[model samples]
Target: MDLVNHLEGRLLFAVPKKGRLNATALNLLEGADIQFRRENRLDIALVKNLPIALVFLPAADIPTFVGEGQCDLGITGFDQVAEHDARRRAIARDQAESGKSTPVEGAPAKGCEQVLDLDFGACKLQVQVPVKGKYRTPADLIGKNIGTSFVSLAAEYFAKLEAEADAANGEAPGAKPLRTKIIELSGSVEAACALGVADGIVDLVESGETMKAAGLEAIDTVISTKAILIKSKNPSNKTLVDLIASRIQGVISAQQYVLCQYNVERKNLDAVCKVTPGRRAATINALEEEGWVAVSSMVEKKRIATVMDELSKLGAEDILVVGILNTPKPDELSEELLNANTMSSPQPSPPTQRRSSSPPQQQEKESSLSRLVIAPLTFISFLLSLFLVDTYTTSSRRRDRGPRSRGSWLSALLWRQKPGSPY
Candidate 1:
């Protein structure tokens, strides 16, 4: 309750407690310089130098918290947010038509705004069937049992198909439709067909090798997804939120690019610039060795090898590719925006003050007479409005759900990929 009441003017940033996306979330924060420390099972960590709190939770819970305004920002999969948004829109429509807010227990909260894609956890929700099965397309499973972890998304996808098919057949849209039976599963969706639990399955595919091993073949992609940063519809601290988001963006950009530095003869400067132009322009310096120029620029990490080969062939020597850490190229930023961000940038605290800190004295000072009278009075009406639902929610997770944390999951390394076959 005390924590709930103290949220004013602070940005609540949620990250995955454990999952494939968990490590990425932590890495982003660390790169953004949001210093935080968690002690002995504490779920929330207050950032040392920023007005932010890091809430560790299941990735699935992030979108809901942001939508309900419990969190200002979060990092989660795009697929999770998509299903949640669809559920919210459907419920809001129902409430509007009935003139009553339908109290939907276990329904996801709405208004989660996707701010950016961090681009790491890339995969697709796909419809897969046994290789030798009679199913030819999504419509062929009209009367067959389909299994998936993403029941909401799969059900919605087939429902839209049902409507489209009915209209194509000249049947009235209002007529009761024959739907594909969707069986929700916690994990192992790939084996659903082989084990007779389903004739087909819908699940996320990073590489598609898992489906192939399970003797399943993909017929269609339901949705493509990746890691994304999201926020509430309207944040209480938009500036802080944007600032952190941009800083994280800078880190992501740094990951995708590396600084290429090389010395080339001044005569070949044009060729080098054409090969590795930084975000804006390359920095060129006159080398002490006459007629030589030192050229430095950002190059896409993925193309570094080809870029190096090209530069060497073009007579450039001492070619070096340096990895950037936190700083991103600021060529694209406007002057005014940079000025505004500079004003709010966190300043470093004195090392002496930190090393000589007195915890007891600090606590006593905060709990002095003035604070004792004012703090309680200020939050006298704060309440933790936790609503428990009796509604039972089914899992849409694929059957091989590994240990939820990224550290543990990596040992098993959920390797999803495709090889050999075309599709």
Candidate 2:
């Protein structure tokens, strides 16, 4: 069977095959209710319940796959995306300088856009040096070798530093500009400095335990990054892409928030609202007991305990916090269901209509009626204006006329237009 033909008309989603982000990405998809089963030794997995195919690739390569339009959406780290973007920009610059329209071999045609932050696999890319080494700052590593997996990002950082150093020197005669060499290391970047392969290293630090275990200390942080959802700049199926994004956003929201419910006195309802304002507005319901109300709201999980305490102080009773397993955004699930129903239902063709000449004849008559009405109204309006001007000029010439006499002409015109007056 041809898997390529099988995947036609389906969204290609790229995910990390194996790495820190791989497990978390899969868990997020499960939370979003995207069911899929990957067979052993296979790179692609078809979603069981949706028109989506998951393509397993390295986290570092996911960005390139999405950017090149080979995949519609992907999950990767922000650090990888930044590195890929930097490489793309460098390639574009080189192409422009060389006056070539063709892209460099292995270069992505375009860059991907970040859709959502997955809020996992949190880490930072930092410049690490020997714990007891003299390198204390990023500047201290000038003219030193820096090893990193992110070659483009590391080179870009050092280029900025070199530019700054040159500017500070102010073109001093015979002064040599300091340049940092960026060495690309695919794995075990922490051992680069200890192995004498590089003076310092730039690498991802989650808890700093690994760096410390390897006898290294972070001198400066380059960028903080975490797992992120990215999409192609131009998607093949925009509706499906948006649907997936909405589902993931809902899952993240569900994880972050808890539903809080309580009963309170009507008089204290105002104060309770101020505490648990919910996402949009608090749900208020009249209780069976007079002067009492039940309120339900969504509150951040981290602050649920504090919120309960505040509600208790405000005379709230029967307070309960409920965990949400899944919560899609408003109208998102309904819209998808509606689209599915529409596709599954058979559409009937409309009855054919015979060509008719009545429309042109009706339009001509309407135009003629408009011309007739407008011509008479315009003529009457012109006559009325002439009479008013003649009356005003004649009144102004009469010096003996009093102010009341000057106003008489206007008043007479108004009186003629009264309900029972004749023209």
- Index of the highest-TM-score prediction: 2
Worst 10 residues of 1 by lDDT: 387-396
Off by over 4 Å in 1: 1-8, 96-110, 172-178, 288-290, 333-423
Candidate of highest lDDT: 2
Give a tens-digit lDDT track for model 2, residues 1-423. Answer: 456678988999999999898888899999888999998888999998999999999999999999999999999999999999999877777687778856469764476999999899999999999989988888888899999999999988887777777789895433233378888999999999999999999999999999999999988888999999999987889999999999898788778877777788899999999999977778787654557777777788999999999999999987866666656773334221222222223432212222221245575788898899988898999999998788766655553455324257564554334466332
Per-residue lDDT of model 1, residues 1-423, tens digit only: 245555566789999888789887888889889898876676787788998888888887889999998899999999989878767766676688779975779755447898889988999989998899899898988767999888878877888888888899998877354478889898878888998999899999988788888888889998999999999986879998889878988888878877777778889999878998877788776654557777768788899999999999999877766666655335674222222232223522322322222344564676695577877765653432111111111111322353333232422343333477221
In TM-score terms, candidate 1 sits at 0.71
| Local lDDT at 164 for model 2 | 75
**Whole-model Cα lDDT of every candidate shown, in order:** 0.76, 0.82
Go through the candidates in order and give the C-alpha RMSD of each one to the true structure: 30.0, 26.4
What's the TM-score of each model vs. the native? 0.71, 0.75
